[model samples]
Target: MAAPATATILSDEEKAVFAELRNEHEKHRSVMIKMDRYYEGVQRLEHIGLAVPPELRRFETVVNLPRIAVDEVERRLDVKSLMLPDDQIANEDLRVGWEYNDLDAQAPQAHKEAMIFGRSFVTVGSNEEDPDQPLMTVESPRHMSVKIDNRRRQMTAALRQYIDPERKTDSATLYLPNTTIWLTRDNGSRWNVTDRDDHNIGRVPVVMFLNRQRTGSWFGTSEMHDVLPLTDAIARSLTNLQIAAETHSVPQKYVLGMTKGDFVDKNGDPIPVWESYFSGIWAHANKDAKVGQFSPSDLKNFHDTVNHYMALAAAITGLPVRYMGQQTVNPAAEGAIRADEARLVKNTERKQVSFGASWGWSMSLRERFRTGEFPRNGRIRLEWYDAGTPTMAQRSDSIQKLSGGTPILSREGAWDELGWSEARKARERQYFLAQESDPYFQRIQEKEELNDPSILRDPVQEPDHA
Candidate 1:
């Protein structure tokens, strides 16, 4: 459910911003409702056919077609790629920020939320210790109120406060980093008239990481909105199709214009009637009646319609038709499978770009939180795990190519490409250096580096040119 339009009655100035936010909230909520309907698989319940008398439905069978709530698009697009720390780690300020979040464990969950909702909002704040790393947090957009500098496309001010479900009073207040004491004075009672207050956690510490943003909107767009129509149409079609089968299984029975007494006994009492009786005998000298055939066309039509709509849905979403469990003839070859995934790969790359920028800035803000002063210029960037996530062989091949190039890639560069953690790389480096210094292994190292068989010959013996 969306928060009430008049969730808060702000002063004249704040009113404008609140109005905009309320508008956004309503749209987001509307999208959410449609998405919920798709997931529940009940979109067809309303479209099923109904007889004039509801009671007639019992005798005439009604079928409900299967609901194909295929959700591969979201899954394929949202696979969590590791967010690696970038060169900015070389700077003391940024290094701390990278480690503070303990992103190794936290990233999978964060990525999942952002992908599911099409966006995730983050805030920067202090950690227990260290300036190198600042604490970054993800806040729910539902509880947030943000003011944007449209031209700058940045958040100018932010507020997050929750009201009591029962008393309706502001039960909790989370002061935005930007809601300074000065701004609070202007907001008046709306700002400080809270039962609870949070002291300064340092400037308004909120930012948005849009999941594939839509045109002319601050909120991220969800994939759910795109597929909602298809899901609804398919579900409705399925229900009607299934119901048609049962209804037609027993076609309309007919009796000749025989007397009404044919249904009654001579005592004038109504003869026992089995309405569902598909077969019976009416003995007469001039008999001429036969059971009507139930043509299989109706059921076939419904089945075909369901498949056609499902194919259309697949087309609209760019989801592979094979994923719908409709690929029945033959298993696809590796090349075909890769081609099918090409569009999804491109989609994921786009997400990486948008989300990567947001995460980078969030880390920068965290570094600033650690040190009261913001670093003038710094290298702070997210290390995105490979979206394609190549197998071991692919990674190794790429690593070799990169390292063997002109102006060879640094050891650090190779390690990063290999997705090695700093700790693991450090251990490997230490072991490498130790081996180089060992006299016992010096001959082996020399021969390995030289790649000459002559080194294996005895020092006193002459090498034979066999």
Candidate 2:
């Protein structure tokens, strides 16, 4: 059953607070939306408009470098598990909630949005139907905004807005530390409090996932902002190249003394310019007419210019040239490829650290929603897969060497390094324990050990006692 909507009204101060937060949210909404358009390959051709004729505007093309830049980093991030030291139950509880939320699929989406729009949000609340599993949702910055308390380094307030075109209503949920105010407006009506919830969590449930945040800034900087101009340039160059191919791919022909009337078909109707140009045969009664051709324009320069901007974009975004569709005569060696990815891998690790914190905070809120109190004993730590590109064989070899003869790494540590999920690790542990306890298997192992010539040669020796 759904929880009944409370009829609590908002006070004047609460209304003003919501208004302020909503206004702040409005200020960033447009910018975030524009970035989203760029990331989606739907941004209007800004530089191509002047060069491209209006009729050829349909030939405009987008290189989609923003998506490439953001996705390249986003794909490297994957959360393995959330850890609570010495608290297996708490860890398992968080894992259950994490899976219940389908964060494996949702997290990458949030990361991409954060990369494109500077930041994204994750909201946690109670699931009335399943009390054990809290409801967690990934929210885009387009419809959400947050205010952080710099000293505390926490979100003090957040506002999430919604629009219902079918119903012609606008709704918003203002999340405060002590109370949540739900406001609604019908058509052009004034905002009215429709519902409220006072959970008194003492902290806003919304957690912001920042991307490339500066030292002193609360919000993050969009990853696409730096390469947007290059993307435009590439798009413009490609559009111009297409237009040139259409208009000048064939050599131009001129008739010095022939008029339009002279270019006529057998029926005496004037031939269209395109038909006459492509017909390959021409005849005129005027003996003074002279025909000549201009060589077709070489499009190599346009292609080279596009490649130039692509290289600049790759450099600025830490992406390999090949990622931008630049092909080389010789393929890059394995070591060289890894070296090229060093900067991108390091950047991905930084994002994992930053975004991991927000995910951990959101899970903590999930725990609070589940138990009505936060876990005070151990801290929540999110475990992420290694952001580098190492083959499975390489990872296995490294794990074996690290775990072989020294106490440098443990079994669990090896499993973590292998990026195995907790469930798989647990299952493997169960199988190992079961095999060790099997009597038949132990008897067969003992028979083989007794038959071994080395064991016979090194027969057991009893210790001497006084």
Q: Give the candidate number with the greatest TM-score.
A: 2
Clash count list over all predictions: 12, 0
Taking the tens digit of each residue's C-alpha lDDT, what string does model 1 give over 1-466?
1112232333565545545654655656654544444444443334433333564333332221122222343333331232324333434334434555666545444554455456667766544354345566666555555667788676766655456566555533334443322122122345333222132544556767676677767767655555555555565555555566567654655555455455554465655566324323244222454434444434766567667866766666555676565677533454555567576666766766776676666665665555555445542455555545355564456666887855455778777767665556768989999998999799887778789655575656966677
Native-to-model Cα distance after best TM-score fit, residue 215 in candidate 1, in Å = 5.5
Candidate 1 residue 232 C-alpha distance from true site, Å: 2.2
Model 2: pairs clashing at backbone N, Cα or C within 3 Å:
none
Please list the C-alpha lDDT of all candidates, in the order they appear: 0.52, 0.80
Q: List candidate 2 segments past 4 Å from native.
A: 1-8, 46-52, 85-90, 164-168, 257-275, 280-289, 329-333, 377-379, 394-414, 430-454, 457-466
Model 2: how far is 68 from its true place, Å? 1.0
**TM-scores for every candidate against the unseen true structure:** 0.63, 0.86
For candidate 1, the lDDT comes to 0.52
**Cα-based RMSD of candidate 2:** 4.7
Could you tell me how far off, in angstroms, the CA of residue 262 lies in candidate 1 after the best superposition? 11
